[model samples]
Target: MDQFTLNLLVVGATFALYFGIAIWARAGTTSEFYTAGGGVHPVLNGMATGADWMSAASFISMAGIIAAGGYDTSAYLMGWTGGYVLLAMLLAPYLRKFGKFTVPEFIGDRFYSQSARLVAVICLIVASVTYVIGQMTGVGVAFSRFLEVKASTGLYIGAAVVFFYAVLGGMKGITYTQVAQYVVLIFAYTIPAVFISLQLTGNALPPLGLFSTHIESGMPLLAKLDQVVQELGFAKYTGHSDTTLNMFLFTMSLMIGTAGLPHVIVRFFTVPKVADARASAGWALVFIALLYTVAPAVGAMARLNLISNIYPNGTQSDPIAYEARPDWMRNWETTGLLKFEDKNGDGLIEFYNDKSKNEDFNAAAAAKGWAGNELTVNNDIMVLANPEIARLPGWVVALVAAGGLAAALSTAAGLLLAISSAISHDLIKGSLNPNISEKGELMAARVSMGVAIAVATYLGLNPPGFAAQTVALAFGLAAASIFPALMMGIFSKRINNVGAVAGMLSGLLVTVVYIFLHKGWFFIPDTNSYTDAAPLLLSIKSTSFGAVGALVNFAVAFAVSRATAAPPQAIQDLVEGIRIPRGAGKAQSH
Candidate 1:
């Protein structure tokens, strides 16, 4: 079959499977819609959580970042995964015991403040919306590439599919569908990685193969990558090149952000018991680690593969002829992810750091009769193009297309649920219409879902940045605001409404202002007043500032709580109740 037909068949079949499951698991009540009726098996919930957590950024863009950034990219893997350890131990069990429909609901009831709930709602919406935009963009990219449609057209189709499944299945449908998505995406991701590892190092294991000796040159894989990159005037693959302080803060930010994200935290609420919540987190990590561990390998191998393809005879010779570039190169170039400029009227494509400040490398290139590197490829293309790069069969390439769509669409559905629940359940029903009927609430949820998807699709067309960086902002916002309030609600019954509100407002404002100063206000052009070259405080990049914001939140909450009257005795009892695993009442329906 042709590539397009195969891609359609695979992607369509997956969508049909999810749609069928949604039909079978149609949520009959608000409890089912919000928490999957709280009977999801721990292992199944873990798989769903893995699929939920590993969005387009994890499945599509993570390896590309590692490929381009090398050792510095370890922050993503470490920060993202390590945060789960914190969630499993410190937060997940208690939250699950609380047994609420939404994160804000827990904070509202525990803190005894409507305003506190509102603050949590705002924070949740911001983080979830920002994160969803990245998924929409990924869906658009995947669709356009594989389906031969424009990105906007792809987004509409993707949105339609998500609407059908998400509106029909709600949490129950999304949860089970995510399990299927996890299987498809993980298989698609690891298979190419294993093949590349075997071809490069004669080792079957991608992670170990990354450290093993390269079969071609008998040098350690990392060492070989470092040599080739340096020969092209790029930073060494295994060396630390970024500032230590920034790296530390960035990693911390991602960790806290991961722990705080509402979409991920809500997954724990779907399981049956507190222990299941904890165990599910561990299982989620195991599943997530499968991809995380192999990611570095894929990145390094793909980088080496591209370098090798460019310099068929090594860096000691002329570049590969432009017309002789691999099919993957030509295919990706059409997507604008890869580009080539035939500088100096040569028919060859040079791939190197032509703008390097290294005088020695510049002088050497000049002596070699080369003008500059003529190839430009976006790092995001590495994963999606891996199968094509290895000359794999069309089925493998088609499976990858389905996998990318699954990754993007599954996360998009999850975020849409979060957004819809926050609006209809938390904001509209909680505040504006406390007497809303169950039928009315369900309709509201569906309407909110439709609106959220529209907004996400609009923003995705005008993306502010790459998937990972955009996701970082969302994490930072969640870490700064919602996470602190939820933690304080469970751990400290002394925290009053005033303390919770003050802490969330302070953290949210500080983080948003700091990010605006660096990333532009609302991410519009010409709004940013400062660059990373001269940061506001301690040289912290906007992406790395979330941890500091979280710290600020904790400090402010404690200080305010000490000065104010403690929460009522009833609130203290509520806090204690959520801490244990037994006798929790049935979760409320609308």
Candidate 2:
């Protein structure tokens, strides 16, 4: 079969499977819609959460980014995985025990203030909407590549698919569908990696291959890769970055952000028991680690493949002719991710690092009639192009395309669900219309989901300037604004509504302002007062500012709580009640 038809058949089959699950598990009640009636078994919930947690960035972009940046990208791995530990330990069970449909409900009830809930809802919407843009845009890109549709058309189609199941099935539909997606995505991700590992190192497992000897070179795979790249004036495949402190901060920001993200946290609420929430988190991380460990191997192998492609005669020889470039390079060149300028007009690709710290090689390449690096490969394409680069079978390529869409859609559903709940459950039912019927609230929730999808798709088309960094920014906002408030609400019963609100505002504003100053004010390009590479406060890049924002939140909240009177004793009792595990299943029985 032709590649396109195979892609259609596989993708169509997976979509059919998900749609079937959505229909079978269609939500009938508000309870079903919001929390899947709190009946999800911990393991299945964990698998669903794993799907919801791993976004397009994780599935499609991580390996590519790691390939381009080398050891520096380890921050993403450590930070993201480490966060589940914090979430499982500090947040998940307690939030599930507090027992609300959304994060804001707990904040409002725990603080005994609708106003604090209002503030939390605002924070949730901001952080979630920012995150959704990336997912929607990712869906568009994945659709454009595999389905061969226009990017705009793909975005609308993807949105319609999500709305069909997500609006109907709610949490029930999404959770079950996400389980199917997890299977598809993980299979797609690991298969090619396993093949690449076997080809390069004679090892069946990718993570093990990363450290094993290269069958051809006789040296460890990573060491051989480093030796070749460094010989070509590129940084070592596993070298540390110049900005060690910034990497630390960035990793910390992602860790805190991961724990704080509302969509991820909400997954715990679907399970029946507080113990289930804790156990589910462990399972979720176990599922998540499978892909996380494979990613570095993928990155390292892909990088070696590309460099070897350009220098078929080894790094000591002239480059391959431009006309002889393979199908993968040719196809990506059409999308402009892979480009060559024919520097020196040699008609051969001159691929090397233009800004290497080693000046001797820079001068040597120039002396060798190499007029600087002519190949401009976008970092994003490495993973998507990895299969073709390795001459893998077409079915594997199709699977990868399907996997990318599955990843994007899963996370998009989770984010939209979080946003919709904040609207219907928090703002409408909890505040404006406390007397609204369950059926009416469910209707409102569906309506809100549709609106959220439309808004996300629109922003994807004309994304705010910050959309490129939306994932990181989303995490930062959550880390600073949401995480601290939830922590203080549980750990410190004395934190009044005023203190919680004050802390959230302070953290949120400072984080946003710092990002804007570095990225752009309101994300307008070139409007930044300070670039990340330029000097900024405390020698921290804006990308790494979330941890700092979270600290500010803690300090301000504690200081304000100290200066003011303690929360009333009734609220104190509520806190103590939540601290125990016996009655959490009925926390919302009121």
Assess every candidate by TM-score: 0.96, 0.94
Off by over 4 Å in 2: 149-153, 462-469, 521-535, 586-590
Report the alpha-carbon TM-score of model 1 versus the true structure.
0.96
Model 2 worst lDDT window (10 residues): 526-535
Write the residue-wise lDDT of candidate 2 on 293-368 in tens digits: 9999999999999888888887645788999987778766655446789879988888888788898988888788
Estimate the lDDT of model 2: 0.84
Q: lDDT for every model?
A: 0.85, 0.84
Per TM-score, the best of the predicted structures is 1
Which residue pairs in candidate 2 collide?
Answer: none
Q: CA shift at 158, candidate 2, in angstroms?
A: 2.5
